[model samples]
Target: MKKNLLMWDETLFRDPEVLEIDYLPEQFEFRDSQIREMAFQIRPGLRGGRPLNTVCKGLPGTGKTTSIKKVFQEIEETTKKLVPVYINCQIDNTKFAIISQIYRKLVGHLPPSSGTSFKQVFDAVARILIKEEIVLLVALDDANYLLYENEINKVLYTLLRSHETYEGTRIGVIVIISDMDVDLSRAVDARVASVFRPTEIYFPPYADAEVREIMKARVMQGLFTGVLSESLLDLVVGQTLKSGDLRVGIDLLKRATLSAERAARRSIEREDICGAYEISKYLHLNYTVKTLKDEERQILRFLAERSINDHEMNAGDVYKAVRESVSIGYTRFYEIVKKMDAMRLVNLQYREGKGRTRIITLRYDPIKVLEYLS
Candidate 1:
């Protein structure tokens, strides 16, 4: 009788080793030029010159944050004179909150939240940076979150123009955004915009071949023998491209591995990949619940229902459908749409030959959501 190679129990093996798979770059395969150009901007700072302000924009999971972060780590290792501070604007959306994060990073102490006015907090920070005469590089990740809130101008005015306010102190700002074409020039006052004429860097999506190479590298380092069939790798790449997001790719791979482990299988087969898709569907829905505001959730639910009645729906049609069920203010509704676009829940595009009109589609297949909801 032939023995099954996949048979296993919980105690059969030690834990699997997945290399820095979570960080985008360990699994990141391409973008040689991007790293070189970005490195050049920071290298000059060592020789006592102004660090360049760079704006990194790309769809989610295209490695914008990861690539820059990698370069940051390398710079920090190479030089002790410069300071690098990174803040995520999604969580720290307010100007005060972002400044507080930077303060704590630079000072090694959290700024007191009580008994300190906003101006006083910033004044103290300026005084310290000036006193130390340290070169500061502040990277604002997810920068677009601050634009519409009218916080961009204020934050930029303080950080970029601090040199003018406090003589001999220099600061650099690196803004990371998801949308490249978002017209933030008008949102920020000209003074601040002119000061932060960031070198624009766009991160395009990974090619299908690159995606396959990334997964193969990850599987070799992360999985044990006989797991992850060649056919399954192709399946994962195809689904990831259709989804048009790299987080989806990571999510799929992680879930599939877990599915195999749950079944006590030493070898992951085709069934495991299929099982991973089912698991991803559940996880994606949970992410939707966690990140989206109540209004955004309602809008998504409305589109799920409308998509059932009709296959493709534009932005206006979906908004009308949502309006029927809720009393949402127009401004709030538009804001929710933009936020959803940022989150990759809904796809937005301009209609070719249709002036100023945009088309919207549910990024996920509705049948999966409707079935899950039922």
Candidate 2:
């Protein structure tokens, strides 16, 4: 019994970082074709030519960001000619902030924090790329956030038109969109769309066998031998499929392993998995809710408060309720609701009735959302 227990200093994880959500694995399995396509698109930049703009579309946890990261890693290791910059659009959705990130990567420092016009920063970035003779490749991960904030066009227009502003400058963009419902063509205006044509690449959800393989690889690398059984691994895979996000499975494995270790057990048990899944299933919901603005959270609170008695409400009712507390118009309210729906925080559907009413419902438990917001 003592031998089966992990001491205070001992842990079941061989390498705990492997289970992390952001850790880049040495063996990025099952994404060869996508990586090849991305590399091919980026090949021109390696040779001092402009890389083709690309749109990587997929649901959350489908390796869209990872594929880009892998390619960017290779680009960094191989050459000084191409400068690959990855921007998390969720955080830096504004045009100034996005360009600042590029400037920081190239200039090795940030621009002045205040009182600087965007053109000044833009010109500085262009000048560096031209003088250094470097091709800039920027990856806007979670680009749908830019669309939600109405900054997509400005950001895209600036990047795609940078070459026109400076004759010797070359730049390319890879827009990684986790939301499949967002159509880039319709989202951008004609002027930006004419030059911002991107080759669309889709990453469908991993098949059941592929998920099993991925989970198995993580288990082997992250855990000690015999810490998790084959039966329990299958359970984790099923839960991952149900949530439709691979991050949940990876998180569940870590949680369940900790649960087992706490119980002084060498091998994971069914109860450990069952207990961890209750919290792990809400991983995506938790993250999405955290990224929402204050107004978006207020609207969610209204829906949660209403959900106690009514499971659904008319979109107009939600808009009116939201407007009473927040100073936003109906159009902005509608966009907020649509954005929430895309993030899977709420379910928005149109009813075939008088004048086609839009209905809104909370996708998660109201109590959980309120707790998170509070």
Candidate 3:
């Protein structure tokens, strides 16, 4: 009998959900200040006042979304005067989609999928808030997508100025921007900016010690005792620090544990961690790629194919290749490239020459990008 072998019904994970990306841990570490500030901003909503508009700026995996979730959870438990609606802009970047989400949250059902106009839907939402005297606090996660789609001003202007139209309807917005390169000041029109003042909240990357502590807490809750050794845990932390994203570490832990289980082992090992990182390091890349539109993906596919032979190419060359399949103009092609550059999917640089040409380079391995796209 093999003592280390996992039995048919046996497993190492104590609570598998804790390792999931969407899992909200009971003990959220290293974000106390952020949590407090968020609570303070929304405190007024608890007493029938509109919540302050906030701009949560940070790199991905830095607890921006989690903080919002935690605060929203508290609001739900505390009162009904404040209606907290969280919208993922990646999935719903348009004004209609965002307002529909708010409507569903307040009206208890979705509006007509097609026949209903935006005005009808918007009016219904405002009327309900006015009748119920409920304040709306909407958090737009990954708001940069709204910017890419040219919908930021429309969304903000509508939400921020709802009171002007409906007198009693109060709506506030919290925009969560994952990309540090996006400048909201310059992105929005002056009209939207005039009424859309937001208190900026920055979430910096966690320190190495903080990362280790958080990982350890997750390990204790997620896996059984002695399933992972201290040294192996250190290695995981080191890999996470190298990537500068905590999600990679969390995904690595889950993948490595499964790798051990696949081998009929009860405990994780060094080889499992190393093997898992090959896939886990691209966690962010995989997520960002999924949110891209058809044209953006086509541009990335062309770049990946071209990258195999040439490490870099000029913007004009990429545009020419992309035009073969898609009917996009030079200006539109340049806009797509700039959006991808902001998303950190590729590197955009300027070449100092007579022509002042722009250079483009893939940030990840060409093979990996192709695999994800396919």
TM-scores for the candidates: 0.79, 0.96, 0.98
lDDT of 2 by residue, 231-345 (tens): 8899999999998999999999999989988987778999999999998988977887888888888877888888878898999887777778789999878888888888878
Models sorted by lDDT, best on top: 3, 2, 1
The digit string of per-residue lDDT tens for model 3 on 112-162 reads 998999999999999999998999999999999999889999999999888
lDDT of model 2, residue 344: 78
Which is superior by TM-score, 1 or 2? 2
What are the clashing pairs of model 2?
A: none
How many clashing residue pairs are found in candidate 3? 0
Better of 1 and 2 by lDDT: 2
Best by TM-score: 3
- Relative to the true structure, candidate 3 has a C-alpha RMSD (angstroms) of 1.1
C-alpha local distance difference test of each model: 0.72, 0.91, 0.92
Error of 1 at 119 (Å): 2.3
Q: Which stretch of 10 consecutive residues in model 1 shows the poorest summed lDDT? A: 11-20
**What TM-score would you give candidate 2 relative to the actual structure?**
0.96
